[model samples]
Target: MSSSSEEIRLAAGTAEVGVQPGNGCRLGSLTVDGVELLRQGERYGSFPMVPWCGRTRDGRFRNGGTLHQLPVNSPPHAIHGTARDAAWKTARQSPTEAVFTYDLTDPWPYPGRVTQVVELTEDALTLRMAIETYGDSFPAQAGWHPWFNRHLAGGDGGQDDSGVQLSFTPAWQEQRGDDHLPTGTRVAPTPAPWDDCFGMPGGVDVTLTWPGRLELNVASREEWVVVYDEPADAVCVEPQTGPPNGLNTLPRLVTPLEPLETSTTWTWRRL
Candidate 1:
């Protein structure tokens, strides 16, 4: 185990994870049996989605009768959230786990504290996030955006498979409009190459298999997940508390007494 201001490394059994607290508290790497499961680089890796998940319509939301506006980082919408652009502080740490926290400020309107926990074991990695209000209550969401490598490439990573295959049976896929926001419809599960959200009221259970190389399952208690497999080199199985633009469609309040929390876990096995 090694710790620094920028990142923390945790290892247990055959797994190792590198967490970057400075860069939006994202996981820099996940290497198991020498194969790097996560896509490397700053924009890649697994990052905790807090305060809100996915996008917020036109970067605006309402609390009571007051309407709040957020910076439109993704143009017409505010993708992800403010928490991922701010640095986080390490609250606690160990050889196989760590806890990080950051206070919500500016652009976000309401004040709140977000905490994230990352734990690693031989075969599984668990991630947890919570948003606690510091003052007035506000609508929010939480989740994770993990960029997984589409193909195994290093250590014993030589493989001939084209890419990892996603396997899941989502009850219904949120109808996605041309503008990329859910059109307020829940239709049957559509075809893959999806960059859309799906409903798993039973909880999110999706698997990624790389032929005879590896197999990983991304699971969460939350019922929503955004599967983005459009990229050529990376695939994202984002398990979130709500759907895209959920703040307007499905608001979850974070009051002083009632905090908003969510979690997702990744369990793997060598194939």
Candidate 2:
């Protein structure tokens, strides 16, 4: 629950909100009056990254003839890029908006840093992260991982009793092994425990409704949304451009861009 006095605050009705954008990561924290809307104790995890989510196997990829090896910090693969848990230099800050930037040079596979801007309006919060690659040959993938609490509907107290209901448009599902990595594929129709990614139906907005009719809507400019549930008090409604381990599946599930080229905007707003 520790926050800076100078942190940006936004209000929707009586809600007090805060945003921090640094080191290619953008984060939002919301509270109603003095009670937390999101999970306050878990607020300080990671800035949610440059590549945004996980990478390929071993962080190894081939661009032309050179095989680049990134730091494997996330066990089986390099997760959330290099800047997820990194400290970002604050670029700008105000009462409702904050911007943070990170620059990567030297031997890192990707040659440029990214800038992330987080804005808080009365009803919603938006985070936009952009990476400007210095060279044209680098591969890039980006998305978001936001954890939402069901307690937000009942004022942070009914988190345990509150159940989460999610609706998406996925025709198929990928099966993963014990390592949490994809192995095979299956046609998923019945609801089950999901840590998988799926392609979105065009123009269809995914919604997660809690006990008190409070809903979180995730609309994407990309093709898919990854719905991950831990079956606890919270669930992750991630708006992503590709599947997990996308680096290995680049130019397929992953979106490829050039230097200074930007990806589509992934947005989420509360309802």
Give TM per candidate. 0.96, 0.78
Alpha carbon lDDT of each predicted model: 0.89, 0.57
Residue 95 displacement (Å), model 2: 3.4
Compare the candidates by lDDT and give the number of the best one.
1
lDDT of 2 by residue, 1-271 (tens): 1223234445555555665433234355665445444544424322454553555677676666778777777776776666655556677777666666777653356567677676666555566667676655465566676666645544455433656678776666656657665564645644756776666557325676654545556665666556667646667766655566765664322223543222333233344
- In Å, residue 247's CA in model 2 sits off its true spot by 1.5
Q: Which tens-of-lDDT digit does each residue in 95-205 have in candidate 1?
A: 999999989989789888999999999999999999999898899999999999998884554655678999999999999998799999999988877999999999999
Superposition TM-score, candidate 2 onto the true structure: 0.78
- Predictions: Cα RMSD each: 2.1, 4.3
User: What lDDT is obtained when candidate 2 is compared to the true structure?
Assistant: 0.57
Highest TM-score among the candidates is held by which one? Answer: 1
Give the residue spans of candidate 1 off by over 4 A: 1-5, 154-159
Q: Which stretches of candidate 2 lie over 4 Å from their true place?
A: 1-7, 11-13, 21-28, 32-35, 41-46, 105-107, 153-160, 183-186, 201-204, 252-271
